[model samples]
Target chain A: MSIWEYANPKKFMQTSGLLLPWVTGLAAIALVVGLIWGFFFTPADYRQGATVKIIFLHVPAALMAINGWLMMLVASLIWLIRRHHVSALSAKAAAPIGMTMTLIALVTGAIWGQPMWGTWWAWDPRLTSFMILFLFYLGYIALWHAIEDPDTAADLTSVLCMVGSVFAILSRYAVLFWNQGLHQGASLSMDKTQHISNVFWFPLIVCMGGFVLLFVALLLLRTRTEIRARRLQALLLRERMA
Target chain B: MLPELGKYAATVLGAYALAILLIVGLVVLSLRQATRMRDRLRDVEERVKE
Candidate 1:
């Protein structure tokens, strides 16, 4: 009847199950096409040369790394205010995915940096903030594991998410605020091309789309598992009581 | 066909390789967890029914 109705485990499971194959198929196609096109088809930058090819993976992974945390923040808020079990589990389900994205971005950035910046690492504002954001993600996940009661864990993580969001925002805007970063200004922008050539741009966009779909497919799969695990725990507890 | 990457071939290829490994690893682990939890839950449900 409503969006929240799908939050019911049965509905969520059935709906996601039907959608999984489609999402997975689309993600595979896009990722394959985008990566192949970007890697083999596009011309090397006049300045950065072939090292620029790394942007396809680095930028999208970095974008998703931040967006994933933001998604968890929203989900955590919903759990705290609306008391939705799905929301809490969704937040939980997303953390590992987010963490992986962050790691991907970091690794890719460092690899790219070695060619461009002549260094594998830097303690600049953007890079440092991102590292802090990764630490926040680690702490949030650790807190979830440390608590036994689901509600308590959800509540604590929700508060932590809210708190971590402030630092995340700072991390995102650190380049703008500090202006002392080895990281360059944003490559993509809404108002203009931001120096990204069309040959490179389209494939990068496609890759980002693929990553988004991949994130959704993964979130759905993980959330459903968490729901099933919770259900099993409840059932076992019931059997014991009976 | 693979494009020539000049001197930066290792950097480009290594980044892609690491990304592939991480993404594939995550997907495999998540799917396995889902399958495992579902199977375990189903088994318990069947046992209780008996």
Candidate 2:
């Protein structure tokens, strides 16, 4: 059976329905454990002090915010190239989740920065690009509602996703292209020297895993709902025609 | 037991609380919406079939 078989809506519903509970359960456990460990057990950072704890939430949410958009970009490309309805619907399903992730990161970042940077807001390149990313999400959602034709909306949103990718890249790498602002360089990297110290690393990784699983479970649930809506629309159209 | 979070205790706790609120809220809302959508779809399908 090809992987694309799961793209069939019925197959998808069955598979994702089975998988959702397990994924959600794992996410809950991991998130709870990671946050507890990071907040209670981990020592305060020497440089930043107690507020360093916010990284547990802020970093993971930030990472998901970017990665979620990247996922939509890929799904959009798949939909455009392959004409897979499920792929398009999956992209639609992911937007709100991605938007929420972006908001969480922005708010948490501001809170963390207030104590560390001594200011709540700045026109830093990273911050500005993230705000742009948020706008892209809102515009994408708006496009979906503005267009009544599902296929046309999918086409337009697919194009929007492609365009938004450039801004997402700018958002992610703005720290590198411009001078680094209040945001720190990526501490987590494939390079061994750049990996975060173990005290913070373990729970951070766990928390990130939890966030990813949460994203997956939610995406599946939302996608299933979208598919059902589409089916209902089709049936109604048929009834009208008959 | 809550550990001493120094002067930033409120801020730290607030951040966590907000994250929890948002994440849990999303999960609950999404699940409820899905269930409702499923029910509505079933009803429409039945009507369309009839």
Model 2 bad stretches (over 4 Å): none
lDDT of 1 at A181: 84
RMSD of each: 1.2, 1.2
lDDT of 2 by residue, A156-230 (tens): 999999999887888889888788577777758888778878899999999999899889989999999999999
> Runs in model 1 with CA error above 4 Å?
A193-195
Q: Give Cα distance to truth, residue A12, candidate 1, Å.
A: 1.3
In candidate 1, what are the lDDT values of residues A1-242, reduced to their tens digit?
A: 78988767788889998998899899899999999988999998999999888999988888888888899999998898889999899999999998899899999999999878999999998888888888988999999999999999999999998988876787677877797789988888785646588888899999999999999989999999999999999999999999
The Cα RMSD in angstroms, rounded to one decimal, for candidate 1 relative to the true structure is 1.2
TM-score of 1: 0.97
